[model samples]
Target: MAKNMTLLWCTGSCPCWRAMIALEEKNLQGYNHQLLSFDKMEHKSQQVLDINPRGQFPTFKHGDNVVNESYAICFYLESQFKSQGNKLIPDGPEEQALMYQRMFEGLTFYDKLGNVIYYDWYVPEGERHDSALKRNKDALVAELGLWEGYLSKQGSGSFLAGKTFSLADVVVFPTVAFLFRFGLSAGRYPKLEEYYALLKDRPSIKASRPPHWLEGPEEELLLKEI
Candidate 1:
């Protein structure tokens, strides 16, 4: 089943990691995959452009069907191979609702984090303002608080959305890991810290971890204050 699929991805990209983790969770092995270098602008190469017009990392193809969006790729894989491996979608209604909520909320969470982390990269130096950067950082801190509260409410549940690891974790874990990788302090958000530690050793996460992350030191302490 895996032989028909191909993935073009970049290391350390949360979206790219999302697709990789999903594939591993589904136990879909032997898929053709290439690691592109973002530093070299390989994501813009003709190969990715052929599969994804936007030239994004995680240009995924299953047979002739292409799924470029990371979350959509996960959903599609689960729907297409429901019986093949671990069930990502929960069966209970409450858990399903929570899973869907967190899955979409993960987008907003990532956006807030990116706004702060990539502020200087995305904004021209002359156009950048300290106030704007502070606002973005404040937003990310609040967003982390919300997630911490959600996890606290989970009580004994180790996984997001429910007691079992579901699509919510698959979608959100990469972003959370990215934030920590960028040096979000572990002390301020203990629940998130614990969650990260817990998921770090999970088979899928371990197997699909960004290779570059293993080779170098963590990025700047961008969120150390918060």
Candidate 2:
């Protein structure tokens, strides 16, 4: 009811960004936000540990109710503050189901992309498996196309959930953003390219972009151009 929300998150964490976007989307103002650092192990501090034993980022506290995990925090905010700004979960049963389905699909898409990033880029050259890398790259390309197709099916809408920017967009935005950061081009997925451009300037998105991304050099890309 009051502006008593507090968020503890790490920079560049996609899950943390999800909570930040949800808060901004709700137009919930003046909430306390603390930036933690993984490099410094700030999340493992006693204060954070007391609230969240796992010491994970995207820790949320609404008065006395504490919630950790990105999706859980986002859902908690959406359900508790539905009267505020844009409705994230949507109203109808079918639309709600679709939003949930698409949101999880976003996770699958990220897992596919993550495999490529981990094996091809993060792993040492000698340690990386060529067969696995190739498989991941192919899977990433296919996953990107699946999202492109979802956008195409929207016809007039620019968002994945149709007409409005829902939880589906919030869930998928970071994955795509990560792809872009890793030098994947949106050029091949025309519909996704358009949708990508559309979300770039959203107030919540602009506010929630990883701060280090502004200061750091772009990561070396691994996925071949599709």
Candidate 3:
């Protein structure tokens, strides 16, 4: 619709980045993007909470529709703007089902890894749990290899969805980022290493990488190598 519509951003979070990746891919740039500071708890400000009751980041205000959850937000942007640019969610039941399946798998299969990483490492050392972190790391190792094996046998290049970048790519990038943030590297994980090179170098990825990716101890200690 109008260029005046604002896309509020927060701390370069993965969920937020999904909408951004789609927007940049389709050349839907230059919408008023306001950056919020997670460090300052700006996302919880009344203005943000009004837009999203859950008070989460990645909340989008597109005309009258208020959207939350990364997957839903990305889906809305893709469908509403489908006529405009490169199609992200392609037509056909097989592709649609595969997209939905992979997206769901990301939440169910991968979110556990993300949560453990967050509690273990992202929570700061004094408050972190060493036991939970180790257990989570072990589980993630097993699961990540599962993805590597799947991709190897699937007859594809980098992505889970074959050639083109799709919802799968959007779903996967942040988890990989999160994994790496705690000193986990794709090199140790094999398939992720290959996928990391492929996904991180995308034009949109280049455009929207979160600032913290380069600034903090997590950036230096975890994400830099990935």
Candidate 4:
């Protein structure tokens, strides 16, 4: 039986986007989500804070167990709903290791790019530092190179870890899609252009692509569309 589960989520945030993609990939159907509002500070209210004292969105509530971190929440969903569609991480050591390795590498890119993308785009002009932006962009460039190398070696045939579409694809593709479509795209990388184009065609991703909105009802609807 599917547990009575609900995700306290955020729209437009990369971390929340990750959870959405993970849920789709696993095909763990039927659970609803409560999309919280950052503008209204709903995440900090007593209702949400009671479940997640850290006041973070994309928090997962499964009966008594609560998961806060995006990555950990995905893991928890996969573990609890193991009988669902796709296995984000396989059971065998060798196979599971490959999934973890690519997924973790994807997280590294999230960290490197997040510093610039989140701060430069979101932070107030006065609060954002030029030096920090440059350094973070540089780090993202380096990480992109690493991804290019990995793709050239592995993402050629079907997926990142060779033949099977695993957690890595779910974790990496959305950011890649955003980067290419809106932001830098292919400022410094050639291999990524071809790779991302192919990945954007994935049905799960195409179905999950969020619509743009400012805040409140419109933004909440966009997230539910995913």
Candidate 5:
């Protein structure tokens, strides 16, 4: 099965990282993989467009099956290879419910973060308003606070869904890492900081650490104030 899989991804894309981590946690080895350059706009190249019309970072294929969306790819892998690797979905009903909740909630979290991070890129400087940017950042800070509360309720050494790592962790960890990578003040969210620290060394995360991240210094602090 591994031999039949192929993945095309770009470095430092959290969605791409999610797919990479899922494959690693599934212990799916020997799969064909390619690293494209976002700086060169290779993610929008013909090769990626052939499989994914959107020309997304992650164009994954399992035999004839193509799963482009990162979260969908993770879910598909877990469902098809349930017995092959670490069980991502918890066995208990309540745990599974929480995993699903957090996993979907992660989408909102990502959207909020993206609004702030990409504000300048998306909005023209002349049209960009400080008020709008502050609103976006404030929303992100509140989102982070909500996550911190969730983690606090779980106590120390607890995964997003429960004691054991689940699909929730797989889905959300990259966004959290992204926050820290852009200098989301660790002191303000100790629980999130711990979560980031704990998961950074996880085998899957270490193995799939963003290639470019290892080669360069961290980028300018985007969320330093928050």
Candidate 6:
């Protein structure tokens, strides 16, 4: 039985955005959405902490069952609602395995990018380490190049896993969007640019894009080389 779904999340959180996109793909009826704010420390409120001990923004609940962590929530939704809405995982074991592999690879890219965001961009200017920042940024560029190469190698396909959009796209699209949010040039990586352009206007993507992003200033967190 598909119980009612509820998601507790903050705006502009990449992980939260991932869950939102997944839910959008699922297109479940009678779901609950509570949009909290990190600025107000709403995630740490007693109610949120009770459901998620870590006070994370992307906590989800299906009836009485609580699940934290973004990807887990996405996987759970895809598995439980296999027959509903869009088919994210796709059919066949080989295809499912490939999708899982690419999804984790997307996380690797997210981690590499986070190294720069956490150490270089988020850290205060006085405490920031120039050498470490450059190292992390260089690593991030390398990660971007990796995806660029992967897309190029995949040939004429518009998606990471192939012709159709799948969970791999759900997991990776936000990371690429985040990179663009930080001002990475869409033009530099033509394949990636094409991919982003396609996904950007997707109904799910547009509906789930961070609300604050529509009203906030653009973050220029990367080097001009992007």
lDDT of 5 by residue, 99-202 (tens): 99999999999999999888998899799999999999999989999999999999999999998988899989999998988888888989999999989999
Q: What is the per-residue lDDT of model 2 for residues 1-61, given as tens digits with 9 covering 90 to 100?
A: 3368888889888888888888889887579888989789988988789889998887789
TM-score of 1: 0.97
List model 1 lDDT by residue over 1-226, tens digit each: 5999999988888998899889999999889999889999998999999999998998999999999999999999999989988999999899999999999999999899889888998999999999999999889988998999999999754789978999899999998898888887788888998899989989999999999888986758787787
Ranking by TM-score: 1, 5, 6, 2, 3, 4
What are the clashing pairs of model 5? none
Per-model TM-score, in order, reads: 0.97, 0.89, 0.84, 0.80, 0.97, 0.91
Write the number of the candidate with greater lDDT, choosing between 1 and 6: 1
- Candidate 5 has its poorest 10 consecutive residues by lDDT at 212-221
Candidate 5, residue 189: CA error in Å? Answer: 0.9
Task: Sum up the clashes in candidate 1.
Answer: 0
**Model 1 lDDT on a 0 to 1 scale:** 0.91
lDDT of each: 0.91, 0.81, 0.71, 0.70, 0.92, 0.83
Candidate 3 deviant stretches above 4 angstroms: 1-4, 120-131, 216-226
lDDT of 6: 0.83
**Candidate 1 segments exceeding 4 Å error:** none
- Pairs of residues at least 3 apart in sequence or in different chains that clash in candidate 1: none
Where does the lowest 10-residue lDDT sum fall in candidate 4?
217-226
Q: CA RMSD for every model?
A: 1.0, 2.4, 3.2, 5.7, 1.1, 2.2
Candidate 3 lowest-lDDT run of ten: 217-226
What total of clashing residue pairs does each candidate reach? Answer: 0, 0, 0, 0, 0, 0
Candidate of highest lDDT: 5
> Of the candidates numbered 3 and 5, which has the greater lDDT value?
5
